[model samples]
Target: MTGSTGHTDTRKTALVVGASRTLGLALAAEYLRRGWDVIGTVRGSGRTGLHDLAEASGGRLTVESLEMTDPDQISALGDRLARRTLDLLFVNAAITRGDLPIGEVPTDMFTEVMITNALSPMRVVESLRPLVAPAGTIGIMSSDQGSIALNTDGGQDLYRASKSALNQLMRSYAARYADDSRTLLLMDPGWVRTELGGPDAELSVDESIPGVVETIERHQGKPGLHFVDHQGQVVPW
Candidate 1:
């Protein structure tokens, strides 16, 4: 989706901010399936299935190393991708520790969680704003736990806080960049079975991903921070 020509079609370009794992990789594959060009970001230490996916995708996919928390790395990546504009950007890198019940939460753990789960991805989106196509979309992978209106119990203090902060930040970002077709979506992938979502999660990655893809495609023209669930319902802010 190159904005230079003002088109958001199947051949549009996509950038997935974190693709070292199942969800990001699956999203990239889905994009390639739809006949779009995809660039996925993996960490220096992680082993991504990108090579196999790229091979399968023929020539529509590419992978690069990214450290979302580092501003220099973010700038370098933006410079690298400056030539090819992006139609979609997915901020999917996040961390979660199972046990962080209120008073038991440590300071360092809280900081780390905030940095990885919230600040880093926000920075990546901000840095790549210019690359988004005119009628393109940006999605932040948030959670149901992030909804302050629905949270009656607070267990995962760090994770919850970080996501909540992300929600707020993206809401403001959407408003700040309103009046253009560049829409921002704050999506909750629901309880999917991933390394972070754990073994007993409700939805499989396959089930949740299609809904997310459809929602993103449908909402590209709309402007706002929509809290969409895996089933494509609007989650309360």
Candidate 2:
């Protein structure tokens, strides 16, 4: 690929985890549209919208299988992609269990949410961080619900807690890798209309993802960590 400046453009590669449908699928598609080679993952072997995207991507997109909650699967993916360098690694898996009060949330449900939304993403980052280019970006799909300062409405307690935990863990990950050249981001894509966002969401995927991609691109070479929304505004911790 070549840029308008007549320089050879090194086409970047992005790994979008949990990219079967909804926001994840949109993200993968947007990256591909922006001239990025994308490796998008879906859980299980089932064909998904991502597969359809791959078919039309002119070999720029590859679909991979990943059950994010399984450590073995994560490790296997890491091994499989070990030879490739990624310009972006974004983990986009999350699940919500209704609006139950924190105390009323079942132990099993709590465990599942925490494992899926919090622990698993960090595990993926750790396992795959080495494959990221020296100046690459590492981003996690975080929500404004995770912001303690913005939690005054006090609803969706369980979901809120999981995202909060995700933010905290990403914070620690940044602290530990303080000297790394790669930029780290926790992105809030806003309430887009998707399966998780439900029918009442205020924004469409088309309205949100392009800006999210731009925000990540804007912060590329700035080291350290940032918690920002799709509009490039920083979200409170």
Clashes (backbone N, CA, C under 3 Å), per candidate, total 2, 0
lDDT for model 1: 0.85
In model 2, state the lDDT of residue 80: 94
Candidate 1, residues 100-187, lDDT tens digits: the string is 6757877788888989988888899899989988778888899998999888976777788899999988877777777767778888
Shift in Å, residue 8, candidate 2: 9.1
Q: Which residue pairs clash within candidate 1?
A: 1-12, 1-13
Location of the lowest summed lDDT over 10 successive residues in candidate 1: 1-10
Residue runs of model 1 more than 4 Å from their true location after superposition: 1-10
Best by lDDT: 2
Report every candidate's CA lDDT.
Answer: 0.85, 0.95
lDDT of 1 at 117: 87
Against the true structure, candidate 1 reaches a TM-score of 0.93
Q: Which pairs of residues collide in candidate 2?
A: none
Angstrom error of the Cα, residue 110, model 2: value is 0.2
lDDT of candidate 1 at residue 228, scale 0 to 100: 93
Any idea how many clashes model 2 has? Answer: 0
Report the Cα lDDT for candidate 2: 0.95
- How high is the lDDT of residue 167 in model 1? 90
